[model samples]
Target: MLALTNATVITGDGRTLLARATVLAADGRITGLRAGSGVPAGARVLDLEGDYLLPGFINSHVHGVTFGPLFASGAPPLAEEAIRRNLVRHLAAGTTTVLSVDGFALPEEVAEAQHLSPLTIKTSAGLTPAALTAAQAVDGAGLTERHLAASLKEQVEAGAVAIGEAGSGHTLGGGGSEYMYIPRRIKEETGVEISPAQARALKEAALGKELDPAARDEAALQAALAGAGLAGRLTPARAQALIAACVLPGLKPARRSIAEAAATARHFGLPLIAHTAPPSLAAVLAAARAGTRTIAAHTNHDSFTAGAMLAAARALKRAGAILDGATFDSFGARRTTESPANLVTLLKAGLVDLITTDYGGGFFDPLPLALKAIVGAGILPLPAAVRLLTAAPAAALPGLAPERGRIAPGYIADLTVLARADLARVRYVFIGGRQVFSSEVTSGITSSSDV
Candidate 1:
């Protein structure tokens, strides 16, 4: 048994905040919460000294251990040591649960990796080979609907709780594929290295519009290519085709593939998590209308302007779809499409149903940084922001709520402790009632006598 006393407890139920509270736990479950130091005799005690205590964060969207290739070419699966380091990073940032949307690795492999870690991991059934090609026509051979259905069913039976990242931009072509993969592919082919700005121009030229491929200006395309040192090496037609192939490999929208994936998700009664941006909004909404409980992942993608993002998010919410906003590498950064302002707009408009960290283009923004930014900016109430990281995600995914989101009796004691002055500074973390991390211990504690 353990007692945490003299803390400001944010219960994560969206309504409770007990100042100078005491939380008691035993055998990995919260026993109770009360005011002051009500430490039961014979129980170990950790005095928080008026720090803030809350439920450990739940990240609804994440990828790294097995899906590193989504952001960089030839990036191998993270080794066990690297995976452990990543998990420690998350724990240090206050996250106790992660849903790894590994697009290529098998569910069994992911589960095996999870077994070696302390973090509670949930996985999704990533796109099948047929679904992958249908979405982007990449390297893999396509699978039939019958085969896809069978495969997903097997994964669900193997403990996959959801189906996603149904159609990734990295695989299907939006920001990730265009900016991350396309530039690398262009360098590989033409031996001309392009800047991120050039890649953005290429994306706009090739896939700016949903159905129209000829929407961009030729002069601008040439200028962008020229800026990237590809002026005389390739013809205009070839450059366009290469750019298009980098994003929309075989199909533009891949409507059939998305529909089949949605159907499979519905058949399994699992939430369908789809990648959505300005170009893919139609496909996501169509899937929602087709009766799949769809989660519009990263609704505030960098591709959409602030106003357009809010409008699209409203539409998704109206269609009974959950809008997920990712805090993608936006900590203490200037305002951009993926900045905190966009996420704030969605939250202010009540369109953001959940918050996540979606790869963050390899930076992987910590949840606490985002929470601190929003709460500090006065755009979101601190309690509400805490709930978004905890109860909201739990409620959004059904499989995680109530049990892990609130600090109450009968709930799993996964909690995070942060200093009152620095919300981003995680001081301690408890998973299943065991102290997995302690900043003080890591900083300089030498022995039991130090305490």
Candidate 2:
């Protein structure tokens, strides 16, 4: 039994707030909650000192936090140590549940990861024919005969909650091409190396943002080559050819897979998460129109201008798609999606339905820090901002722990205690009424004797 007293409780419903409340928990469930509730005689009590207490966060679209098929590219698994470290980072970030949208991990792999961590980890499946072909085209080194032979129905029956992350950047001329394939191919062929941004500029210049072959511009391609340090070494045609080889082979197949994936998701009564960047937006919109419950992943992809992003959001909403924004190293590395401007635009327009941290090549920002940005900008109130990481995601993915995203009585006591001055400072975290982490404790000793 535990009693958390004197906390400003955000109920995770985007509105209800309790001032200086006491939340009592026993046996992993919230036993009682109210203002000035007296602690029972034998219960342990922890004073919050008027700090903010809320439901532990639920990040529905995460990646690279498990020892499984890495990404939609079906790359090799990350080491067990790395997977544990990533899960610990998430635990300390106030996240209690996360859906690994890597899109190719098997249910058994997810179960294995769950056995290794305290966090509740869920997975989505992607075993469509086109998805596999696309993965094979790029990097299927991680996949085995079991993965290749597994059907979506079998995987879902084996406990995969959803179908998604289909047609990813690795196969669709998005982040994967810029960061991994384009640079690798360019360096192997031409000794000069370029950054992901430079690669993106070159690809856009040659094939345009839509990856259309006919959209190539000779002058733009020449300028991009010079900018990327390929000026004298290769002709415009050669540079174009290099980029085409890296992106075009799997582009059409991956795009075609979106519709197939959506149909499969619909048949299974599962939500479909699809890549929603400039290159794949059309296909995603088409999937949404076809009546699949579609989640437009990363609508704020840096490739879009403010206008383009807003327009895309509007179109997706019109097509009955749910729009999600990712804090992809935006505040720290600025590697893939450079700025949080698109997120701001989405929030200001009330276009975003959920928020997540898409793995920014392992530099993803914490969910609380993203909420800090939102609250600091006055884009949303603290409660509303917090909802995107809590109730919203829980509602979006029903297979997620639906009872854990609120502070109401009878709910699972998955709670996060945060400092009022800095929302990102996670002081303590409790999952299912068990105190799993505390900032004041180190090596079995409290940092302050007063604690």
Candidate 3:
């Protein structure tokens, strides 16, 4: 249905990347990707003018829960138009594919997808339901085994794409044992949830080895460590409970959390989109326990040691795990220079991560902003950066969609046309054989013609 020619193609498919080629798209699927300068007859030719064309984005994690104080009297945050506008932003940002956070889809997505229409959406809503925090303490309540089973059944019916970033912020779930720690001061001192710095520090400290190795055995070691207060806030009793319930995924009989997420996905067989980023390690350990190869979004805000991250990745790989850099709102505000630089460093070091847009908020495609940050921060080479946003994420996309990220034959024709020098600034976007947005002009439909 469309031929994108004379363009510098940045195929996110990992194999054919940064190639100067022609991409043929029909019915929203990539029909042909020839590497020469020839065009088929009678195809409406849209010359990219040497701009860049790549697969539209696949965003993994984002909190679309009432995007305001959960207890506030706001007008049902993320209302219909709000969701629509936010989705538009995703389109504008060249995000043809996006996995909305938690279990809620935008109103537009529901309307569009219910008719069996062609809008890229996937989920495991039943197994892992995620909400920022229904109540202040609700953040702790991730999906229980019971919740996972029930929710997964419904998700299969509703067609949810994956499980969740199921943990609570200042949650009260997991026996109040393996909790997201809020410093006694922050809880008593201020109203903000958790400081990013503290989170980073904790991640750093976790890489250390201090488990009762000196006691010659596990129990005497617990006593020796407890004497030293080396266990930190994780009380021995609470830690044991957490090990049984949260940490040691080996003991579970029913497939709860990660295993539940995987089994549901594998049973009905959907890709597990674990809501993550800084939150991924916990989920990864849990999912590995369950023997599922799921994708963790955003992986987190902390600066993890490369060795630790690699070990984690290797472990995940052995268990067939995939990790994505995981983030939301490409058009969202840029982080402080110091913070973003750290993320860039991790990306460059060959850490197993991907660029994912956290869609479902203000409507804006993320490619532009995300590209800007990667480049501005000086992370990868220009082409590599583009690939990070394109090819990398596509590989992590579950279910026969790897081709979806590239401009090769048999690939899905979800593509974006943008400036080569600037991968984010959108010039035109096409998804599923439709010209979703175009910046320049449309024949017989000028603004003046409308009048």
Candidate 4:
């Protein structure tokens, strides 16, 4: 028996609060939740000292955090040490569960990842015919015969909870090209180093946002080349050819796989988490129109202008798609997303159903910090921000959480304790009623018999 007392508890339902509460847990399940102080007799207790207790965050769209084929491109799996380090980062950031959206990992690999960490890891399957073909075309170095041969139904039976990340940056002419492939090619060919933003400018100037070859602008491409310091190193035409070569390989097949994966997910009555960005907007809207249960992953993609994103989000929501806002290191390293304004806009307008941390090249911001940014800006109250990360995601993913997203009786005792003043400062973490992390020693909180 364990008792957590004297806490300001925020139930994960988005609007329930119990000040100075005492919560009881036993056998890894919450046994009671009540306001005011009263630690039951003979129970082990951790007095929270007025900290805010919240349900552990549930992130539905994450990549590169497990020992699986990395991303939708089917690159090699991360090293075992790197995988464990990523899991620890999530755990320390107050996330208790995460769904690996890499979409190509075998069941045994998923299980091995779960076995490597205490965090509850879930997997998604995306090895349909078109999706596999796209993977092969783009970068299928990690894909094995087993991965290619596995069917969606087989993956579901083996414990995959969702179907996603159908069209990724690697396949679409999106961030993967800007941040990775295009830069690699340019460095190899011209010995020029460009940032992701610079790479994006060059790609879009030549191919446009929709990646249409007919939309090319030579003048704009020349300006982009000069801005990226490649004026003498490469001509506009040569650069366009290189960018096209890097982005167009898996483009058509990858676009086809979005609908294919959506149809397969709908056929199985599962949620389809499609990559939502400027390039994939039409297909994503079509998926929603097809009556598939769709989660528009990362609707606040850096590729979208605020108005465009809002319009796209509105259309998808009206078409029955759930909009997912992502924290792609915008609040932290500012690597992928340069600003938090887009996320704030979606949240303020109430267009976002859930919030997640998509791996920003493995530098994704913690979900707690994202919550802090939302709540701190007054766009949402703390309770509402908490819900988007906890209850809402659990509900969206169905089997992903079942009974683990709320700090209520009968739910699993996966809870996070944060400083009342700074929500990002995690003071303690309890997973399955076991204390997995504690900053209490440095936070001036000490165990005592007093209520």
- Using Cα atoms with residue i matched to residue i, what is each candidate's TM-score against the true structure? 0.89, 0.95, 0.65, 0.97
Kindly provide the TM-score of model 4 when superposed on the true structure, using C-alpha atoms.
Answer: 0.97
Relative to the true structure, candidate 2 reaches a TM of 0.95
Ranking of all candidate structures by their lDDT, best first: 4, 2, 1, 3
Per-residue lDDT of model 2, residues 116-186, tens digit only = 78899988889899998888877788899988888888778877777888888888888888888899988
lDDT of 1 by residue, 1-451 (tens): 7888888999997777899898999999999898877777777778888889999999988877542223212134666776777777787888999887754445656766776668887877755554555533553322334333456557677777777776666655665665466778888888877755577776676546462466756787787777778888876677777777766653443444556668888988888888887666888888888878988998988777888888888888878898898887766432222356677778888888889988755567778888888888887778888998898899888864349988988999999998899988899999988988888845321222223
lDDT of 1 at 108: 55
Please report how far candidate 2 places residue 231 from its true position, in Å. 3.3
| Structure candidate 2, residue pairs in collision | none
Write model 4 residue lDDT over 211-231, tens digit each, in one string.
877789999999999999999
lDDT of 1 at 291: 76
Model 1 lDDT at residue 134: 51
Model 3 over residues 1-451: C-alpha lDDT tens digits?
5667677887664445545577777766778877765666656566676887877766655443222211100012345455455566667777676655445333333445323323465533523332322221222233233332354465456655555544322221111111133232233333433333332222223222211112123454355334434345554444333222322221121113444455655676556665432333565567655765577544433334545555565566566656666443324543311233334545776654567644312322366776776766676655666566666655655542445665667766788877777765888877775777876666212121122
Report the Cα lDDT for residue 90, model 4: 93
Identify the leading candidate in terms of TM-score. Answer: 4
Off by over 4 Å in 1: 66-76, 127-129, 139-150, 195-197, 209-211, 226-236, 250-254, 332-338, 442-451
- Show the lowest summed lDDT stretch of 10 residues, model 3: 66-75
Off by over 4 Å in 3: 15-20, 35-37, 63-77, 104-119, 127-150, 168-267, 275-283, 303-319, 328-332, 335-338, 359-365, 372-395, 400-403, 441-451
Q: Which segments of candidate 2 are over 4 A away from where they belong? A: 442-451
